[model samples]
Target: MEVVRSKEFIADCSWGAKDLASMNGISTRLHWTKEPYKWHVNDGEEVFVVLDGKVEMFYRIGGAETSCILESGDIFYASVGTEHAAHPIGEARILVVEKEGSV
Candidate 1:
């Protein structure tokens, strides 16, 4: 038996349960989990699409909170200088996109 896994960022879900589709400047990540964590983006704009779960997309602005709920097919985007986070309420697969030069 043999098992192959991605050597990229931390993947909390099953390695074989998800497929990663990526190009030189863009990538799509898939996952299935009810667990949650905080994601940090150093700079640039980021977009997230919820594939199959309930999610709470939150952002912090000057000590206040702005948020939204994302279900299947729902998408959210965070522009530069906005600190945002997400929490999974159910199992899901998420897609994240970033501009080519926007690290």
Candidate 2:
């Protein structure tokens, strides 16, 4: 068993993550970021949870771009083939769950 303090966790660099678990080909991770992530699509669905700070999440659907601001405790679900990226308002801590080895 292990205890992870998400708010207090820090990464070595922007968008760096700490692996928390992997089971049945799915992986859970805690990420720290101070910048925007590149736009990309995951091989499978993704669950993004904001644990601290704020984030501006951008995505494209049917080739139409959209975005939303997510604060702590907000959750974003990205279905498969969803093209998305995250721009943190500042230093932010996020919990992400997705397929193992997925970008």
For 1-103, candidate 2 gives per-residue lDDT tens digits of 9999999999999989999999999999999999999999999999999999999999999999999999999999999999999999989999999999999
> What are the RMSD figures for all models against the true structure?
6.3, 0.5
Residue runs of model 1 more than 4 Å from their true location after superposition: 1-19, 99-103
Candidate 1: how many backbone clashes?
0
Minimum summed lDDT over a 10-residue window in model 2 is located at: 6-15
After superposing candidate 2 on the true structure, give the runs of residues whose Cα lies further than 4 Å from its correct spot. Answer: none
Q: What's the lDDT for residue 67 in model 1?
A: 85
What is each predicted model's overall lDDT from 0 to 1? 0.65, 0.97
Tens digits of per-residue lDDT for model 1, 1-103: 3343422324566321344555676655555556765655536777878766678888887878888889889988878877777787856567667654443
